[model samples]
Target: MINRRNMLRAGVVAAGVAGGVAVAAGPASAAASGKGWVSVLDHYRDAQGQERDDAGAIQAAINAATAMRPVHSVLVPPGEYVVNREILVSGLNDAVISGHGATLTLTGAAATTPGASAVLKITDSERFEVSGLTVVDNERTQPYNGVSIARSSRGTLNGVSVYGVKWTGLGVFDTTPGASTDIAIINCTAVGTRFGISTNGHDVRIIGNHVAMYWPSTAEAAAKGGVWSAPSDYYDGINVLTGSDRTTVTGNTITECGQAGVYTQDCTNLVVSANTVTGCQLRGIEVDGGSRVAVGVTVSGNTVVDCKGQINLVRARDVSVVGNRLANTSAARAASLIAVNVGSSHVSVVGNHATQAHPTFPAVYVIGDATDVTVAANEVVAGTPYQAPASVALLYRSAAGEFTVGGRLLATKGLGVGNAVAAATPGKVVSKIEVFSASGASLGFVPVYQSIA
Candidate 1:
């Protein structure tokens, strides 16, 4: 049998031929000469090619490598390893665990019940990397996370896949007051978890990943709650929660989540851009201030389809929702395409395209003490007989801004200096503004300032 260590020791080399000409392969010994490479299969396996309960052997190898130097790498080759309990890798600096086609199949007590430990936990570590591995929980009902990193800084989780877990697939959190910073989750895929990826840290980058939550059938979705129930009861694709700052979630595809595809709560300085979100039971993307103030949030260049609501922001400040495309193809039961509500200020909704097949829903709805909002140059087309009283190209209640119709200001409203004005119609020739009172009574159109040139 060609075991992993023997294969590495033999330094297997292969040459390539291009156009019937042979080329020399690089030095075979150079590839296998890393002093820090330790194979887990060599030290802990049964006679029948089955991995033992050797979490301790893997930890021992890591400790041996790290004790000799500050940096090391542990190699896990292609096989299934059964881990009975959580494996801890703590207090290591500049360490890496690289798995090539390796799968860690968790079992036993921790896999049978909900516990505080994760399948693999890395804590109090810095400059770490875990890549090219798959972690799964066969007992899907247990609440074991695939990987948890807490109080760690400057870590990278690359090309990893995690599935069949009960809780979050990857969790990056900080228990202390100061935030964990510079964590990157790149090119990872997670599915069928409660949360695909979640973070409560700062300066995190989540890029080019595919994350999906459980997609229950219509009967199953209704049993959890209604289709439009509160998002707290359902799964989220990617979540950046309280006190997290300067986070970027971009270039990701999220689908089939029960809650918002990309959600932020009490998080500041967030950028959610270029993500494709679809078939969510709730809002596609939501940024809520909650008790803390969320500021400097930008949701741009996203495509959202077939969601109950899309792009919802509440109690946020200095937020920009720009250049997004949203569509509703079914009967709309929730809110509008874009909703800005309650204590939000300095918001800009610009250059978006929204289409609603249902006649009763609004394209954009803005209400409740929101100030300095600019809804400009959006193309919103809805079916006839709009049922929501506030359903229009631009709907505002107790919200004040400089309103424009086809690049012409409404002169009757007496535009104030520094009042932000937006051309509500993009391609159309006619421009109109229908104002409404707080009680949903129509105040009629503000007279156009002048005819278009």
Candidate 2:
């Protein structure tokens, strides 16, 4: 068994070598065959002790461990180590870097490039695992990332805490499309960064993470005024960007971000489910396809509260937004609980509960040019209507066509007057169409034409 005392004694013996130099040990020195575990402190502590940069020692241990016929584990004991430069781990298969309550602090000049600026960069590796580590970059003036995994597949980053990064905290990126796959980022916490976690890989799972304080503002501004009152900047809790497909983001808590709590742009086959998002400056969850027509996205079983907009999908196809609880305590102005913008098709918004204190905007807003979209089984409660006519639950705007209400063709509109329904007079459109119970009491007004021309 490897305990602290034995490890410390071994480290003392390794430090006693002549010339006080760090050496990369061979396989013969390993404690076990085919399963080697190298302690960073035992083999690589600096001559000047904890006050000096021990990154070289850790890097040497990583290189030595990777050089073994079979890959091994690099154990980082509980201590504060400073790394002035990026630590690169490349081409290592089945390697594990396990930090047992270790904290790696980054200092000095920031690298101009993304790969160099990352505190720990892993490239061209497979089956790598990094867990139980705390990486901090407290220098706000410099751009840095906590971890960057590029061109790496089948990697797991678990139980890591990354904070105070100038740029993204954890980035899983690849140069080519679908180069990186099966990456799992689980139970991680990222705070006070510009972007919490950004991925450009396929089949990635971002589960049970807590991302917070991503708004770009000072503590004084947030304390005196609210987080929303500050000048907003672009930030996302978890961003699944282009080239990422079949990604899953579930059971995460994201709060106080400048942009969407969970955002997917130009990503296909994405799932954002069971997340708690609150106090976001922009939409809570957004699937935006910038002229590319993203397909097969699902946003379901999320709790979104106190956001500017709850859900927004733009130019996407074959999307499903279901079983989400959305609310806004503040008075509404122009945003809705759910907004399906133009060019989206084959969409389903079902079984959602939405409420707003001031009912200025519609609970669900479906814009023009969105085809094959269905909004059903949603319960919406709002206060008195503002400039709009009466309290209507659903608002839709489109060209004259056969419109369906409650799964039946209630009205067919003609092109004589742009707004005229076929069953109605030519120059005048149907307005304030209400749905009532069998008792003839008005349940509420269906979302008929409210100045939609």
Candidate 3:
């Protein structure tokens, strides 16, 4: 019988060797993985026993050391190592830079100034994993970004905390003059920044992160104010763009942001599931453009409360909104699910519950030039004169093609709008519009304008 403990140790040893480091044979090594391990304080020491505070030590240990192979890990001891200089980490293929129990803090004179520099910059690396460290960017006082991971593939940041970043907490950019893949962020937190985590990478996964975007005070805004930024628009969550594909945002809690929780643009094959967004000033989830059919976007099992707009899909295609609960705390006219200004086709909305407690509006809305969008299997209920007009549903001004509506309720004082099937080429044959009720009963429907009071 292969013991689970032994299997874990063996897996670590295999990873160590595959990463280009030799497996060390010892009882202590067996605990984590017997491999070439270097201590940040001891291995990269000066003439005296006291370790150097230079960022060069870290770079030398990972990038310049000839004896230390790839797939090696640098262990930082438990202490505050203030980095006054800019550090660049360059690695390739399965390199690990880990903090055992130490705090890697970026310290500089800019912490008292208005313009500093980025703390750590990573470039031209692949299969890199960073864990168990607090990377603080004092750009609030100094004015700079915290950490940037650029041109790296298969990069993973785990149990990391980044705060006080001026621009973005974690900025993953495509700067290699080419493209990279496979980025994952797990158990990370970012606070006090323009954007918590911003990325332009493909195959990305952001899981279990806490982001709080606080507005700069009126005094601070006046001191360091600019035309490009305002007291609003500060986001503490994730913003993704630049033609990103195959992205998954799961198990995250984002609160108190000025703009949005998760805003995605130019993305394809995306999934935003199992997240909690609260106290956002603008919207919760927003998706815009893509090349091919932007399909398979599942927004499921999320709790979105106290936001102006809950889920907004604009200029996107092939979307599935399933099993979500939204509540608007303010008296805004914005619907819980608003497909405004989107020209997408073939959208399926299922199993979503919204409280139109907000005054004078519909709980759900399907507007824009969206074609063949179906609003089925949903529970939308609200009071009289309540804005969320659809106790059950609404399909407004949609370029009609084909609709499959079943198992939904439109609960409002306003009359429900029917599907408007547009012609193929303005003169071509228009397709038929179908409707089904909450109990699967077929309701023979007509066009919105034709269906009267």
What TM-scores do the predictions have?
0.77, 0.77, 0.72
Q: What tens-digit string does per-residue lDDT give for candidate 3 at 212-291?
A: 77543433444656211455436547877756778888999998676788888777788898899886767888776644
| 114-164: candidate 2 lDDT, tens digit per residue | 434677888888877787888887765567778878887888888888888
Q: After superposition, how far is residue 166 of candidate 1 from its true place, in Å?
A: 0.7
Q: Give per-residue CA lDDT, model 1, range 1-453, as digits (tens).
A: 233334443332233222223323322232422554545644555456665555765666565555656444566655566677787878656656766467777766354354366788888877777878788876665678788788878888888888867778887877752367888998998887778898989889999999976576534466766554543324789989888889999999999887879889898899999999998877899999989779999999999987778888888999999999998887645457888877788898888888877777676777746777777767677753122222223432222443333222333444312212344555442444555544445556543444556
**How many backbone clashes are present in model 1?**
1
Cα error, residue 231 of model 3, in Å, equals 6.2
Off by over 4 Å in 3: 1-35, 43-52, 64-67, 109-118, 139-143, 176-178, 216-233, 290-296, 332-337, 383-453
- How much lDDT does candidate 3 score? 0.62
List ranges where model 1 is wrong by over 4 Å: 1-34, 45-52, 111-115, 217-234, 384-453
Error of 3 at 46 (Å): 5.1
If both were scored by TM-score, which would come out higher, candidate 1 or candidate 3? 1
Q: What is the lDDT of residue 55 in candidate 2?
A: 79
Clashing pairs in 1: 360-387
Ten-residue stretch with the least lDDT total in model 1? 384-393
